[model samples]
Target chain A: MRGFPSDEELMKRCKSGDLSAFELLVLRYKDEVMNFIYHVIGDYHRAEDLCQETFIKVFENAGNYRPRERFRSWLFTIAVNLCRNELRYRARHKAASLEDLLQADPLSERFLIDRADTPDMICEKKEREEIVRRAIESLPESQRMALVLREYDSLRYDEIASALGCSVSAVKSLIHRARQNLRKVLLKAGLGEGYNAGI
Target chain B: MPGYRLKCEEVREELSAYLDGEVPIWKRGLIRWHLMRCRDCAAEAFELRMVSRALRAWGDVTAPRSVVENVMRAVRLRRRKMEEERARLIARILRIAAPVAAGVIALLWITLLPAFYLSYERGKVRPLRDELVTVRVIPQSELEQLVEGRMF
Candidate 1:
């Protein structure tokens, strides 16, 4: 009805009882949404569940979708809200350590190894990466969220602000502070100078 | 004015933004003037630049393929189950409403019409019964005898 129906078109059909359209929407966004959630929650299993739940909400609430907003942004809004809820729940329950967050899966190990420039480099890089990741994980929730959205997702400052419901300046400050903290951690690990040289 | 002296602490504070190229032009000039004279500030800026470079390199690190696949699979299953639930709910509501509408229509046709007809028939039968009772109470012969006595 309105300019051919991008995702909104499919979603409008979905609201009018088009099951196939809804399925198509799900197929299109599932991976992107899953990846975002995985990085946000820092746990594969939980992120998996949250990703499923996100789609379920999208499907059930399809009727509530307004054409004025980008479908992806709205969908991600639902996801970011869910992630915030999950993070809050985790905090209430007790914080999960970096060791707990790291996947012991052989696949992860293999993935790291494959990316290595050499066998010795792989081990050294892996150790450094682990330390850096831990430093990131140790960041305050807001800073971690800001860095992840910007660094991993490549979201712009405004998008990060929108996702986190903060001011643009606040997002910038968060990322800057996160980078500073990471630098400190790497410096302490004796990898800072080496990492700098390699970079 | 005395020659400007840029403190190491002040230069270090601006070094992060300098490395990011976010330093304003005026600040950049001041930082350059300071760096030209201050080795410590110069070294600090270099170190900050290196740190940024390392972080940029860290971006190359990626999650495993299997992890990605596993997450995708889980997401797919979740969506499928939700779609099924939505369909089931719509079907259930339709099922309930369809029978309710049919039952209302059948009740009007099979029960309401007959009951209305029977009520009309009772109305006619009541008037007839009153007429029959009046006739039985006063016969034609009694009426004729009253007229003949009057005449005599």
Candidate 2:
């Protein structure tokens, strides 16, 4: 009555230099980790590279993983740290902010739009998505990260705290502030009807 | 529980945590109590809820297939390099070990084997040989007489 090996079990095997187990882990979480990075930094190509780097770091540091820790939280912690470093690098180099960079890349935005919609609808939807992305990017680093982890990845508060290396209370505050900020923006843009009617 | 009531600001602040189900049961009941009577606070909560839904409905971007492919490729390459390094280490050890082993055998033949044989021959075999008896045989002419009388 044995099921498939868990993430911790695969990590244990990875510690013993089992590449197959490492590959299984990669195949399982690659998209999630990549998408998280993309959302955080708003760059697809760099996210791909950082996603690969995250797995490589996990592979190299497999021995450091304790069985008691949640594998998903630990994995996110690595991804978050790399995103921070990338952001820091961008700041240090005076590169354009994520919102501006994403604005310049309309082709990348086009792929995210559904083709079933008419051209006009597609343009409108793309504009809405861009506004949302921009509103997200405008938040402070910790707030943006907390909101994304909770909203997209559906991590528990404790998991978000662990991934962000903060206390649960701090995470709660960050998410609350992030929601309030987004609510303001979404209401102004008239993106969601519930916002206009209810508020 | 009967006397407790949360202020409007307090309820609104913790509303996100309440929505996420991170609040304790008692506080949750209090927030619910406040939202029931306060129209403004209820509207605020509803707005936040809708905001959460909108973000969720923002949809997702799928990770390109190349991400996993490139990751696995890097992992496999590193593994191959590690294997090659181990092979080289073993080869180096053998390269060093083969000569050392041959030298030890040569040294043993040159010094120890002869010394062992000499000691054994002088100490045990020569003394044992000195203590033995000898026997002699009759000539052919005496054999004919021995055949007639069967005496020696």
Candidate 3:
């Protein structure tokens, strides 16, 4: 694993005019970046758009990359900024309930643990997941982003702080406050054994 | 902050870090003690854990196949557009320059031909005129005397 060209190496190759290396870089980070932005913006389609734009910017501006910086953080910096822009756009346009919009996609069988569980229980679980999803969506941008990066990407506090252009303590406070907000939102929508089922 | 019975607000503050295992060992112990007895704070911790779990379970969202294709497509499209613009600009310059060059050549020919013709006609008469000047011209009287003297 150590012998393989790291992301920075690939980026350097990309800087020297290797499209294949850039493509490799894209393949490496695409899903992670997509999911990060997806959680941030709450719309998968728009997340995909922003994810493409992020890579495009990276590809075009590979020359600007400084090797001292971590590529993942640098990449997320671009991603989170784009997410912010989309969020601003959504706010102005009064978009609502991204889970509702994207919920049309059928839950794969993996979400169902046991066939023995009654369909009613399954529906109840899905309903609770949706509520949790909406509660997450309702968080303020910075808080929501911190929570997403921390939980989904599993980035360290300092790394997340780097990505978000904030201090580590600020990142911690953001996630903490975000949890408090989530608790309020979730409990208000009714949290009990069902919402906490899978966990 | 050590060796103190933890307040619920303090536990709330530490929940995210505690869930992440970022809390110090002693602080974690403090949080453990707090959650053991406090139902509200414990429930909050449980819910936050659930949230983290749900997002983690999202796994890879797996961007549609078109995303990668679209990125490369856009790159190619921009390159093509620039190539077309460069070609169009060259054509535009040629369009302007070709007529101007032809006009200059035509003007030069139209102006120089008459000058060349006049020069050629001048060359034909120049030596004749010079000869007439070099020879001494005799008036008609001198010519008649010469002819009368011939009778003598």
Candidate 4:
């Protein structure tokens, strides 16, 4: 078995001014962190930028780290905070509307609909995907983060709470409320007992 | 939706916990029992679960390689900048402190040189004064007669 330094070990080294440890951390978490931010902002470019920013923060704040805590949770906490800041900026600046999300990464849009799909099938899938995306976009920021961290990232409730800067019960409540809202929207979009219908 | 003494609201509130497999065993049993009987709560739980499942179906994307490279480059630049800043601060402190230290030494020399000189002169004169006293060996009455103008 190959031996690897734990994140806490690397973080300790980083706190002592080791840039290599910081780089190692960035390399380790860039993908998942980027993906998390991508789910949040729905823009690959912005998500990638936030990933850089997140590491920069980790690098700068390494000195403040407590070795006893989980490093990944701390990393995601930073990432989540940066994502929230970006969201706040967007809201404050009246920047890109939710419609921008569909085309944020054009490749992803096509990835969902097969080339072999009939026009009607493609249209239906596109519509459903669009509704789902909009429903997600419509979610309150906190709820959206909770749902994203839970559903896509598969983080535990406690980890999600840590990342969200909320309590476990709050995390649960956020997910519950988010699901309730999504259910209402999806059902109103004419999904019935057929919600189990495969996408 | 509370009625007939059934905790429908409470069940709805915790259905998420139940779905997440986080509910305690007793509560899990209670929720399961409630879910078994109430059609409305059951449908609601089912729908929420489906929504959660649909969300999981959202695909994951890989971070671009450039992100890692750019972050590493930026971090290195920041580290260099920090080191340079620290060096500059030290140099600035030295620049300010060196002259202050020199001024303090010069001031101390100026203030205490006379005292040092007087102490040195006193050291030289003290032995000669002692030798004179020993050579004379005059008694107090004799010194008094000399001071009274009597010839020695």
Highest-scoring model, lDDT: 2
Residue A186's lDDT within candidate 4 is 75
Model 4: fraction of native contacts = 0.60
lDDT tens digits, residue span A7-42, model 4? 999999898888787778888888889878988887
Query: What does the lDDT read for residue A87 in candidate 4?
Result: 93
Q: iRMS for all predictions?
A: 4.9, 2.3, 3.1, 2.4
Q: TM-scores across all candidates?
A: 0.59, 0.78, 0.68, 0.82
Which rank order by lDDT, best down to worst?
Answer: 2, 4, 3, 1
Better structure of 2 and 3 per TM-score: 2
TM-scores of chain B alone in all candidate structures, in the order given: 0.48, 0.54, 0.41, 0.70
- Which portions of model 2 show Cα errors greater than 4 Å? A97-100, A103-107, A192-199, B86-152
Across residues A1-199, which tens digit of lDDT does each residue of candidate 3 receive?
5567899999889887677888788888888888798777756677788989999989877889999999999999999889888889888998765545655444323343357879887776666556766777778889999988987787888889999999988998999888778767766776644447646
lDDT of 2 by residue, B67-139 (tens): 7788888888887998899999999999999999999999989989888998887899777789887877989
| Candidate achieving higher DockQ, 2 or 3 | 2
Give the clashing residue pairs of candidate 1, or none: none
Model 4: clashing residue pairs?
A: none
As for candidate 2, its clashing pairs are none
- In angstroms, how far off is A53's CA in candidate 1? 3.1
Q: Which portions of model 4 show Cα errors greater than 4 Å? A: A110-125, A191-195, B1-6, B120-152
